[model samples]
Target: MLDLTTGAVLWCALTGLLFTGLWLWYDRRDHARLAALRHRATFHCIRCGNLYAAPRAEEPAPCPKCGHENTRLKF
Candidate 1:
């Protein structure tokens, strides 16, 4: 038979571990999603040399600084 205080401590430790594991899982998932988005949407302006992001790899990634319609280069 477990003591009352020991049981309470065990419950608290289990809850804390559960929450921490959940947080880490969420954080890793978000990081992967963000990384994929970053790799897809990355671009650089040819005119002003400014880096920017676009929704898709289509043409005319407009530069916010110089207003240039930059095209995405194929790798």
Candidate 2:
């Protein structure tokens, strides 16, 4: 009877740990995906009326169609 009780408690603890690990893994993956998306700066060229995205938001990126430097579009 004592052995059976101990086994049940061990199994419950193992299941809880497994769920916690899976939750943490998924949370980290989602955060990384969102972080990558947030780094891309969207731009719109007034000269050629073109819209595009480039890495980093602090600087200007040249328009691919018109070769015009455009500041990052504000939200």
Candidate 3:
């Protein structure tokens, strides 16, 4: 019952809508994951003022902030 020209247009529209929805969903999910990671406890170097977060409590780590060779205690 549908004309060939109409069918082609419909198919293109549906495909475009599907791709747009997928892209939005992916972007939102990625943003959520980054937000959660930022909530973790990270330390900043007093000398260089760099931000560093460790997975676990360990020895001193170098300050990525100022490129200092010394490790600062993480709280």
Candidate 4:
């Protein structure tokens, strides 16, 4: 009993809503993972040999010991 125009509009609206929900979910999950990574401590500066903490493997945290830019070091 639905008209073509109405059906198209409804379908578009539903698709938009579905995409929005998916985006929100993905963002939330990503934020949670980043938060967890931030709390972890695992990095060191090769130049100064100073130890530092970073949340993730790609973070660019500096060393507090020698004031040098640090890279992530695996423990």
Index of the highest-TM-score prediction: 2
In model 3, state the lDDT of residue 13: 99
lDDT accuracy of residue 71 in candidate 1: 74
- How does model 4 fare in lDDT? 0.78
Clashing residue pairs for model 3: 50-65
Return the lDDT, model 1, position 56.
72
For candidate 4, lDDT tens digit of each residue in 1-75?
A: 999999999999999999999999999999988887667768768887666676564467767776676667655
TM-score of each: 0.53, 0.76, 0.52, 0.54
Each model's lDDT comes to 0.83, 0.90, 0.69, 0.78
What order do candidates take by TM-score, descending? 2, 4, 1, 3
Error of 4 at 73 (Å): 14
Go through the candidates in order and give the C-alpha RMSD of each one to the true structure. Answer: 4.5, 2.3, 6.3, 7.1
lDDT of 2 by residue, 10-68 (tens): 99999999999999999999999899788999899989899998887546899999989
Please tell me which model should have the higher lDDT, number 1 or number 3: 1
TM-score of 3: 0.52
Q: What is the lDDT of candidate 2?
A: 0.90
Q: Worst ten-residue run, lDDT, model 1?
A: 35-44
Query: How many Å off is the CA of 59 in candidate 4?
Result: 18
Off by over 4 Å in 4: 39-75
Best by lDDT: 2
Backbone clash numbers for all candidates listed: 0, 0, 1, 2
